[model samples]
Target: METVTISPKYQVVIPKSVRRQLRLVPGQKVQVIAFGDRIEFIPLKPARELRGMLRGLDTTFEREREDRA
Candidate 1:
């Protein structure tokens, strides 16, 4: 396991290997989620990456609406 030190300003540097593995870049947003006793850091996707993820969801939602009606 890699070790990191938190700076006095509450900032910690993610190691180079970990950053490369996670595909993290400078100024990228990260989400810190609390899971039980540990925290998970998830990288936020850029808006372009989220554009078409809902393509099938729209049809599913319409089908559900029609079923309810």
Candidate 2:
């Protein structure tokens, strides 16, 4: 895991390796989520770009016949 130091201005620079791996570009928006004791940065993708992202995935699920109504 790459470690980063938080600057005195409360900003942290993402490591070059991590940034390149994630294809992160300057000025790109990211959502910061605080879960438990860790933080997660989720890239904000355009809705159109998310189209067909789950193509051919297993969507089958068991359900009672009555539930179909």
Candidate 3:
């Protein structure tokens, strides 16, 4: 297990090994979720890069439009 110490500013550095494993880069945004006593970090990509993944979903665009309509 890896351990990191939080600085006085309440900021903790994600270690090199962890950064490499997660492919995290400087200025990358992460979604922080608080689940009871534990916290989760989820990486977010630019919306444009996610277009293909959204297109691949089984739901059709018309179905989504009708639901929202």
- The best candidate by lDDT is 2
Model 2 residue runs over 4 Å out of place are 58-69
Between candidates 2 and 3, name the one with more favorable lDDT: 2
Q: Residue 40: error of model 1 in Å? A: 1.3
Q: What is the clash count for each candidate, in the order shown?
A: 0, 0, 0
Residue pairs with backbone overlap in model 2: none
Determine the C-alpha RMSD for candidate 3 after optimal superposition of all C-alphas: 4.1
Q: Taking the tens digit of each residue's C-alpha lDDT, what string does model 3 give over 25-54?
A: 999999999999987889998888777776
CA shift of 17, model 1, Å: 0.4
CA deviation > 4 Å runs, candidate 1: 51-67
Candidates' lDDT values, in order?
Answer: 0.86, 0.94, 0.85
- For candidate 3, the TM-score is 0.68
Worst 10 residues of 2 by lDDT: 41-50
The candidate with the higher TM-score, 1 or 3, is 3
TM-score rank, highest first? 2, 3, 1
* Model 3 residue 27 lDDT score: 96
Regions more than 4 Å wrong, model 3: 54-69
Model 1 TM-score? 0.65
After best superposition, candidate 3 residue 20: deviation in angstroms?
Answer: 1.0
RMSD of each: 3.6, 1.8, 4.1
